[model samples]
Target: MPCTGQREREMTAVVELEAGGAKLGLMPDVGGSIAFWRCGEMDLLRPVSDPHLIAQHGRAVAGYPLVPFSNRVAGDHFRFEGVDYHLAPSFGGENCAIHGNGWQRRWGLDRLANSSATLTLDHAPTRDLMGQWPFSYRAQLRYDLRENGLSIGILLENTDTRDQPVGMGFHPYFPRHAGLKLGFAASSVWTNGPDHLPALRVPVEGEWSFAHMRDAGQEPIDNCYAGWSGSAFLRWPREGYALTVEGSPELRHLVLFTPPGQPYIGLEPVSNMTDGFNRPIIADSGVRVLAPGQKMEGHIRMTVTRC
Candidate 1:
């Protein structure tokens, strides 16, 4: 990650990495986000067109790491270790906290290289902030750009003295165009209730089935698919390119969110299903509890190929 570009935001440094005609732009200060990823003139990840917008909208960035937990935690609350923790609503309109605090705070640059970079965030339990999580933890994210594609690794360590519930994932936005096809292996899908919590777990069939490569269609999908095979494929017919996404086995759940009429699709490789903390222990809900000083880590790789 030979660094370039001036500070874009308040103390927010923008770094660019290049390898084998592939380029990646990173904003370490902006929740360790990837501003854009491109190979030649084609975009492998959806690029943020306006730099000014990223400061106010971190989710609109090309990609960002999800730490501590993934997705909503019901009414911004969860019980762990016989104690209840309440998190303030992280998003604008949503009543529950979405994603984790990592995306909403700045991360420190740990290391930088020509083709890779590492960012770290250390969260200590404080009177004001700890009320939301009630635990101390350290999160590390590394982005490596290879000749074929990009690989992202996330590590979460429970720095507190007590046990803590943990989940992790990656939210990467990909360009969605007409004639695009998606394929993945998942045994079931999680239906959301009115509050966007997991209402039910249903088998993957009919419109929710993506066993074979097929167009995403017009139906809106904002659900988590359980029993994921840890791999997925997205093909762009109009661009004559395809992207293969593979994740570590720890990432047993896949959350697919294709907002109607949106130009991009979010295929997230997550460690747990929605509201995993509150749900019963199931084979597909990839939730885990880390003891004091314990750490959990996972990786996701994206390879691009010409169709």
Candidate 2:
């Protein structure tokens, strides 16, 4: 079933996956985002039981796929292959295109099982969707349930006739506790400007540092760290367990969105940074241009265990 409209999110049916002490719920009609994830009664991602809530606010869902690109496109326009394309200000509150159209459109079930499923999204450029992304591509998300964990595999193919810049990742929302500590390694970070887009590239230091296990959600952060070690973990000292997030090497950037006062933290495994396509040094910005018919695949896995 297709998404009715922006406001009228008519839900089709939710796909449920269960195995190895894990339960996952996915709403194919609602941007194919994860509704809830639980491992033995413990919420892995921020669990949402209300289908209406998932339909209304996809941004608050447990997790979602970021495809064709991740994060913002900046300035509502970008120059590609010597031609300039202007992204319509699809973001209602801002004059920029953010987070691509994947997380807002509908996805179909390609296959399913007790613990494994595949969701597919075929996007042919449209005048409306072109406001956020003006490329033709097919995105496939393969979700597998593991013992006390879950794994997501993404495969994106450039279905366009011309070269198209592509990026992809998963945005998993994790519950943050008072004693939660995040551990990750990165060489540098892209600091956000007033517009919440990366304005400066700086070394990982001060509040931007996560090289060692440090308290998370205490300070506000919404930056994309480059040169990621391809893995990160959140340890809840008070809870006695840790959730480790591991991404494929191709997913070179990790976006940490720990908003102050918010109960959830988003540790996104992305292939590019905010506005990477518009960066001056595009070569080093993590954006890859895919030739016609070319495809790229990556995966992210999250496992839980006692600390």
Candidate 3:
């Protein structure tokens, strides 16, 4: 959102993809965010009717991406290799940089096909990307329309001459209903402090466990999960449909954000945790250091079916 202190690009045109009975809408200039995803008459990703709303809060659209790194970086600054870097706060945290640079900067439409489109973004330390994330990287978000749903492919390349900490994530919003249920398996949960940084790492159990399908109540849950099964299942009994999210192994973190009384649920597949940079040496933090010319890639697929 603009209140997050990142530059909000003006809304350009939306690129669309249609295959079988599914349709995917993407806004390349608006942080490369997805405006909508629909299967037949059913909205799969909580379609956003107005693009302006997405322009204001790029994350307000159906979904947006987290690139180079994901989640909070703590203090709006981070020191790497004895050098300090300053970043703009996102998600409205005054001192913490949240969600990465991809969701706030405009992305170029590299290639467009009938059922797929690719958006590209190049970040340079000198250019600042409006947030001054100190790294030179290339990110590409590819959206493909499938027969029953869609898939997103993320490719991040380290263009800097030295090693750089890089990771990627996807934030997708799903319509919430009283009869909705979610199922997933995770070995650990990273509890957050009042500031939303990682406070504790605890075993998944009780309310934190989703090993089997359970009602998705109107509860407040904003924690990151680790050791996931690489997938999650969401079903709506009353709606007679189900959705599945599959992620590549590179996506080691799963974040669930369910705010009370909100109409949508944020189910994210990410590569790192909140303030992961702070614990740079901890493998559990999910940070990956890439050498020059090296790249990392991951996939997230969403498939829907009749119940």
Candidate 4:
């Protein structure tokens, strides 16, 4: 038989492993910002260029510009490592700065066979950053996708000879419209001002308790939970699935933000609490400082399973 000019192309491409009759779209470019990651057949992880997406996912990572720094002078102004650094206000502020420099830059892509992919981003302390938070450092974000979930690992290295304060956090926007619920095991809660920066540290209060399932619609937040058990349990009852977020013991804090008028919720696993720069350093708290030529690395794994 002679073949006609007709050909067929499938609509859905299998980007990664398959199980339970569902194909995973693990590494296809979703949009301009995020690489589309499907959790087996559970849900589609949409990556967008908009910052609001961070708010939409309930827990998308936010940094380099977390919240916004309103006051800044020439050279990005601040002092660290025994030096006065200046950083041009990326968001235009004059009083102080917010979030370190990381997210705004475009990261490089390194695909690892089929099971995983790596997103390598670099932040070389600019004269602006140097003038504000004076220190030479490198930041990297690595995303590894698997059959059941994805793990985000962050590494920050000190390139200068002096010790500097470093604060890193993960912002994940979780789905909220469904029967979504959040639960975690933690002991301390940091007090913050109306602007959402740390004001004090106190014992965990009622409702703030996350040892049990709590409806997403019932609570409002922009606060951090400290002395965590280093774990959190998240579930979408409507979807019949749950995700256990496991962090390193070094990752002692988790920030939960329930913004007004958003469909998603944020469950951020942070190495330090908000306004970390201005907050009093707990006996052993604050960003990890490494000696020159030294490196520090940590992991935050999110494992999802159907109920």
Candidate 5:
């Protein structure tokens, strides 16, 4: 079903997908983001309450996809194939390019069903837009709602004339409440420098460890974890529910962001580490170079269960 709402002067529309008691709300016109998701009466994602903020900042919504690359690119520039590529700072007042360009641009609805939808964005070379990336490409996002949870697929193809460096990921914001626990197995975590660029890779230990289910207390965090096991779990004892996150093996990295005092946390599955393009000499950096006409695809599934 289709739903429309207005926030300030900008109007936004949502496409609803339902299966059994699970419902997903998507806004293809707003950065192809997930407006809200619920299973029965329980919210699986943090719902955006401010309409004006939703109209102005799509990334601030529940969930948004990252394409071509994920996380921050230091100095807003990188070198590929002996050519230096520069990107305009997409995030306001930030000197680095964050989360690629997908989450800020509108995606065209390619197909829609009662419980599923497909959206596409063609990044054709343009003077103002496509220059952010050195190559032209097409990105497709498919959202399928199941009886228990939601499944998202991301497909990116290199339509440029030469090879291109690529990476991708998903940013899902879940409700962070008391008695909430996060569990995931990761081998190492990156320590961020003053500018938020990864400065060192250290073993996961102490407060940075998530090897078992434990309450994510008020410790501030905004760092990337490497060597993820492709599986994660979230438990909310107070809400009597839990969610299991599973992603493809290509998503070898995860970024956790727990803003101080915010009622939400970001558990992201990404294909590369932060500033991966700048560290091309590192063999396990997770950056992929795709030749012309090549394509890369990955999927992430979130299943909810009542405790």
Candidate 6:
């Protein structure tokens, strides 16, 4: 198990793995950031004022970016297989529910190695009751630390006898300074209204693009993209570190979110998409249809390199 940081008040645990002159800090709560992985700086991730920022610092489970459904689940209800599943509005909105109830839940930590650890989170059958969608599901998150890199694997197991439509994704905020460059490949992008719902699918035009490093700062993009090439890259040329995120072929979609004043950029790799219920993006990404007792898995791997 990684040792808890010397400062107990932080109340966060760190698992450090050293290789190639780089250390990986694995925080049990703050998701995965280089601070925990590389021992860079503490204040970089430990937010002092914003409770929500502190809440998201390094914890691994509780669903990183969003949950059972990322962004807004669209009234916590969706029609799947001709049946309507109404999920309670855990996110507290009129008809739109924001994020899912994954990050708020606790996850159990299993194996703890210097460079790796496995965390498991459960969604009881009752969790689905409030929303009208009922099913037993377990999500396991594994972080394998290696030299200058980390691999995050997610496994969603449907223990229910009836087939249910499921969605999951990672919402990691990459540290973005002036010297950072982000790159990814996508064929089409979705246009959205103020509510963050998909308004339409449009071809990648001039500036609202990720095909290359094309001024991601000037655009306001809270949208989903299909026909992704399956990989995304972020490079800090001045810092000499680059992080790579890739998903299985099944994860064919990506959500890029740029909030106006935030220092970090969110590159979300998801199995399904925002408002997938009405949009039904599962089929486009090869969303798995689990048998009575089956499991679906995907991974996001990152390698940090110092040039």
Relative to the true structure, how large is the alpha-carbon lDDT of every model?
0.85, 0.82, 0.84, 0.56, 0.87, 0.63
lDDT of 4 by residue, 126-178 (tens): 65445334567665556566667666677777777677667666656666656
Clashes per model (N, Cα, C within 3 A):
2, 0, 1, 36, 0, 20
TM-scores, all candidates, are 0.93, 0.91, 0.92, 0.75, 0.93, 0.80
Per-residue lDDT of model 2, residues 2-71, tens digit only: 4467345446356889987788888777777888898775787885332323223534468888887888
TM-score of 3: 0.92
Best candidate, lDDT-wise?
Answer: 5
- Best by the TM-score measure: 5
Q: Which stretches of candidate 5 lie over 4 Å from their true place?
A: 1-11, 48-60
Task: Give one digit per residue, the lDDT tens place, for model 5 in 19-113.
Answer: 99888989887778898999987888995443223223533468989998999899999998898899877766567788878877789999999
The clash tally of candidate 5 reads 0
Model 6 lDDT per residue over 1-307, tens place: 5346545434455556565545655544443322344524311121212233323433333226344555667656777778787766544335655555555554677777766778776666674345534677777878776665667787878877778666767766666566667788888887877776777778876765667864457355678887888888877666666677888865777888776666666788887766776765536733455666778777887666554
Give the TM-score (vs. native) of candidate 5.
0.93
- Using lDDT, rank the candidates from best to worst: 5, 1, 3, 2, 6, 4
Q: Comparing 2 and 4 by TM-score, which wins? A: 2
Rank candidates, TM-score, best first.
5, 1, 3, 2, 6, 4
lDDT of 1 by residue, 222-300 (tens): 9999999999999998898899999998998999988888788889999999888887566557788899989999999
Lowest lDDT 10-mer window, candidate 5? 50-59
The regions of model 3 sitting more than 4 angstroms off are 1-10, 47-59, 127-130
**Tens-place lDDT digits, model 3, residues 1-307:** 4543344334646788989888888988778989888887778787443332322353447888888888888788777788777876665425666778787788999999999999999988775464647779999889988878789999999998988887789988899976889999999999998888889899999889999899888889999999888999999888888999999999989999998887888899999988888887677788888999999998999989999
Q: Which stretches of model 2 miss by more than 4 angstroms?
A: 1-12, 47-60, 280-282
